[model samples]
Target: MKLKGIHHVSAITGTAAGNVDFYTKVLGMRLVKKTVNQDDTSVYHLFYGDERGNPGTELTFFEFPNAWRSRPGTSSISSVSLRVPGDAALNYWHHRFVQYEVDHDDITERAGRLTLAFRDPEGQRLMLVSDEHDTGIAGGKPWVKADVPAEYGIVGLGPVQLTVSRAERTERVLTQLMGYTKKGQYASAIAGQPDIVVYETGEGGSGTEIHLEERSDLPQERQGIGAVHHVAFRVDDEAELRAWIDRVGAAGLAHSGFVDRFYFKSLYFREASGILFELATDGPGFDTDESLDALGESLALPPFLEPHRARIEAGLRPIGTGSPS
Candidate 1:
């Protein structure tokens, strides 16, 4: 099956409010949806992306706190790198982060792209690349700076890098099944990073890039409250996704049967490398439950979770509501 691009990258979050504040206020992404976790009713699932909250532009979070901290090793790829249009815009991000007292690194490079490395409040390793794709993902509150143009601001999430302890299982699934080609192995002294395996859909990885982080320095990260829960790749529809479900099962990897996720249909499995991977069907989209303009204002629950909304809302820890703070 020829894979399209990414649907969204899903990660773990601690609190509803704190997750909202960081994505909206700090990164300038919009809170497109505020919902509860389907598997676990008590926690929230937050989505942050561009104005339309389109596929390939989304970065979702599963709010589950008291999660164990992980080391920066190969058992998973933990960093989520967004993008800026140019070096000047990247410089702006570095300084802007200082306002929040967040530490960041100077500009660096990886897999043929300029990048800035840093950590979030929960130590989720993140980076921002100065790479632009041809599709022209639009609709973010552009970062306004004297030195940077609105268009040159963060274009969207460039790639969510996963550091896995082993590469074989995830590698086969990415190349053979998910349609990612082997780009190359990348090691960057500039970024102070370990050697990594690179994979992506189609050629040149113009849309979203996936890096297999195999750092000998660290071990497999434990997934808990602050760890990235799962990374989702996009599929055109059930027809396209079904092909994947068959392959995953054929490969002898037990996977969840296709499950409807409202905005998309989903299937989950742990790749041989130990990182959790999800396949999400695109569309029915962010507009499914709320109007295009009024996303994230109230709690949204899946049909199954709908019956227990009152109890779930009461159970979650409060998160920042609108904008930062």
Candidate 2:
């Protein structure tokens, strides 16, 4: 199958309001939509990303007010590394994190770039790597205008590393099923460090990846707020998505039936080894609500939810991606 790229990355979260605020105000992500969890109505599902909350740029969250914390283990995939522009951009973000008191780590060079480590409301380890090769696709905070040069802004998602106990199951799905070939060892995860072995979609680093590290010492990861809910790879359309579904079924694995997610169609399934996986179609994007110039100002709903707009709107908790309460 021809997987285009990463559609989006979703994670679990606790305080829905607080989580929304952090991604928007603190991280400068635009809140594109607000909706109650389709499966669990009391909770929320918030989306944050660049202008219009474009695909790949999105960082989605699911609210679980009183949920157990999942232990970080070798079984699940976590840690999404965002590809930022350069070392100078890293410095700008470092000061910004301090201003917001978000508790981010100091600058360090690793894996051939400068990176800053930090946590969300739920202790999911997330980082920003300074990369010079971006396609100039980015969105900033409302108050923070475009200051740094285009080269310093975020380009795309860098690499998504999964901490798995064993790589056999996931590796088979990656190399044999998907079209990722084995690339060699990654360098120290610090700035000015060597590059690590990277397996990408045909072209290196352009698509979603399964960066594996075997760790016997680490325990299995629990599905808690702040933990990754799933990693979605892009498909050309619904047909391609169905093909992937067929492949998973043929492999004799269980999967969540296909569901319409408005911007893109999606299906969920756990890899044989571990880690929640999603195949998303990359069309009918975020332009449905508002426009390229004005997005996230109003609530957006999928077609099914539109019929019950009154009830849906009333039931949904009012929140934005900025100004944490």
Candidate 3:
């Protein structure tokens, strides 16, 4: 029972509308699903991804209208990475960021790949990694209708960075429990700190990597706007996910066992360092309720929530899909 690469990364946003604009308009990702947080049923849970909202391509956000800006520190999903076509794509994005006034850094190499680091208006940390040398799990196709050219559009998720106070504890959970192999380590961007270690699972590549950064100089992160909620890795289906639930339970880790998310089944558990990790299925995808042609154009709910659509819609402020006007 091996885990696939990243399924999706979910983060917190304060304004659903602005989140929509930045991710869809600026990043050129398709707003693949417009849904409410199933647990809450009040605020928005927006999903953005490549053309069809494929498994590894998804990046989601939960809207908490009044959430305070996040405090950057250890014990957090510090940085999220997006995959682009190649080095040239990074140059395209750098120029585009300038045109759109997006906060970003000059293109630089990280872990032997060209990357452009940037943040959303809300200060959600992100980097676009070049897939030029990538050869593991393949990336997703770009949305055909996106304003950004297909060659230069963001493709799928890359290695996610986890900053923790106790790296060895998290490393044990990753290697001993989760079956990730320690690939290598890189010099941390911060001086006087230990090197950030790299870990990978199924079909090792940028998409399948986790860059673990150990930072003792910072405080524990408080979840608020611009903070990551959880990072999910892909499992093939429900049967595999159930097997994983059993494995996690055997390890004595507390977990949310076998949740039916409608689109995909999931098993959630927090690792030793307090970072939430979810094992999610790759199918019964975004097209389950909505058609490929009209995805994210309207609000979607699971069958159970369909009965409360009116009440749910009433509580949400409209965050129009498609290109921003």
**For this target, which candidate reaches the highest lDDT against the unseen true structure?**
3
Candidate 3 residue-wise lDDT, 151-234, digit = tens: 999899999999999899999999999899999899998889999999999999989899999998999998899899999999
* lDDT of each candidate versus the true structure: 0.71, 0.68, 0.93
In model 3, where is the ten-residue run with the lowest total lDDT?
A: 316-325
Off by over 4 Å in 3: 320-325
How well does candidate 1 score on lDDT at residue 316?
70
1-325 per-residue lDDT for model 2 (tens digits):
8665577888888777788667765666667766657777566777776655656677788888788887787667668876665678888888877877776898876554568888775687788876644322332323233343444555456567776766666778777776767755565344553333456673355335546665656678777866888888878888888888888788777888778877788888887676788888877777765586655556666667667667666655556443211
* Candidate of highest TM-score: 3
Q: For every model shown, what is its TM-score relative to the native structure?
A: 0.88, 0.86, 0.98
TM-score of model 3 relative to the true fold?
Answer: 0.98
Model 1, TM vs. native: 0.88
Ranking by lDDT: 3, 1, 2
Model 1, span 205-274: residue lDDT tens: 5355687765555655666655676788777888877888998898888899798988888889888787
Candidate with more favorable, higher lDDT: 1 or 2: 1
